[model samples]
Target: MSRAKRKIEHIHHALEHDRDYYNHFDDIDIVHQSLAKLNFDELSLSVEAGELKLSSPLFINAMTGGGGERTEQINGEIALAASETGIGMAVGSQMSALKDPAERNSYEIVRKNNPDGIIFANVGSEASVSQANEAIEMIEADGLQIHVNTLQELIMPEGDRNFKTRMENIQRIVEGVSQPVIVKEVGFGMSKESVECLWNLGVRYVDIGGRGGTNFSKVENLRREKPFSSFENWGIPTPISVLEAKSIHKDLHIIASGGIRHGVDGVKAMVLGGEAFGMAGTLLRVLLQDGRQALISEVEHILHEVKMALMLMNARSTKELHRQPYVLSGKTREWQEQRM
Candidate 1:
């Protein structure tokens, strides 16, 4: 099948699948405070990342693009939702658009819809300076997310073979591009070492796209001649990945993802070290199944739930949530200890 056809298939499989290794959520807990002096309306979660000033810490993450009519329609709907909600959003890999100019409108629809909201342009880690620049220009991107998907590529039958140029590509992009380049994981999660490397390379933003979200291994395996079932459950949990990234650098802005299905997970992610939370699967489901109005309602509900979580802990902001006392247990804690 063509890559564009494969892209749509990937989305279908992601929606109808459940391949999470275990309950990573079981590993994280935020201590609730008995007293909260402020009202829910007083919660100020204004997140300033790169040049984007979001109303809240939640953003619709990168997914779907580079196909024909159906892909564009999906992106258009997702963009409209983002525009209405006033949250940051990202378009999936623009490589298809770059290669085939006909697909540009599919990704560009995001910018056309969300003119003012924070929109991130995305590309693989192997993208050159020109490709990255073109992607950002294509969307008038507020920021650029260079996703590292080594494991996903390994599972993909037609994926790139030589993967040694990622660091060099990232370094060049960061140095050459005026927009802030964020190094992100494609669901496998980011490690301390990798985060530290990005920090040293002048890349200030990182998205720890941990496991427990969409399983790309499963998505890709279904397309291959033979499935690699054993690798399906690979990678660190989302919260653990956030802890690991935070351990490497205090100043790097961390965006948490990977199985962040609801507001409660977003709250826990903030406590664990996420400055901003990105929800892909859950938000996608809501938008696709229930339509735009329902998607808006769901986002509003999720944000409200996150605010309640903040009030429960008396966290006036996500920064405060990060400072709040929290405990890690179960397999997450054990893995953390072993890593230490």
Candidate 2:
């Protein structure tokens, strides 16, 4: 199948797949403070991920583009919601556009719709320095995300087999690109060792795209003639990935994603050291099912929920959430103890 055809299939499978599977965020609980005094009106939802600043900590994560007109419409609607809510948005991989100029408009619609919003251009880890620059310039993106998805590629029917130069490619892009470079996972989470490697290669922003949200393994397996069911439950959970990334470096900015469902989950991620929260499957489901206005309302509602969570924790801002107390239990605690 062609890349564009595969893009639509991925979207369909992602929306149809059951995301109710345990993501381990439930294993975390932020201790509420009653004696502490803080006003909700004074709380700030602003966050800084590397050099890119976002009005709200929650942003529309990479979802779709470069499939065709359908994807262009999808990206346009998502861009509109991101613009209306004043949050950052990342387009799906621009490799298809780079390979075929006709697909360029599908990704370009994102920048056209949200001219002033913080936009991020995404590419696979295998992307070259030139491809990365073209992706960033195509969207006029504030930053660029070089996503690492070994598991997804293995499961993908037509995915790349050779992965030897991914790290080298990422290093070249980081050194070659002027925009902020974010090395992210494609839902299968990152380990402390992986985070350290990226940091050593001059990468400061890491999106621990943890498990429990959109299982690209499952998505790709659905497209395969013989599915690899065992790998579907693979990879670290989002909360655990955040802990792992934080355990590596104090200065490494972490964006907690994969399986992030709501505002409460976002707050839990923040308390665990996620500089920003990214929601892709959930936001895409909202947009495809309920339409653009509904998606915008859902984004607003999530922002509201984040504030409410902060207020309940007696935290004045996103930064203060880190100072607040939190408890980890179950598999998440076990992972934290074993890993950290």
- Return the top candidate by lDDT: 2
Residue 152 alpha-carbon offset, candidate 1, angstroms: 1.2
Residue runs of model 1 more than 4 Å from their true location after superposition: 50-52
Clashing pairs in 1: 213-259
TM-score of predicted structure 1? 0.97
TM accuracy, model 2: 0.98
Per-prediction backbone clash count: 1, 1
Each candidate structure's TM-score, on Cα atoms with residue i matched to residue i, is 0.97, 0.98
Provide the overall lDDT of each model, using Cα atoms, as 2-decimal numbers: 0.87, 0.90
Q: For model 2, give the 10-residue run with minimal summed lDDT.
A: 17-26
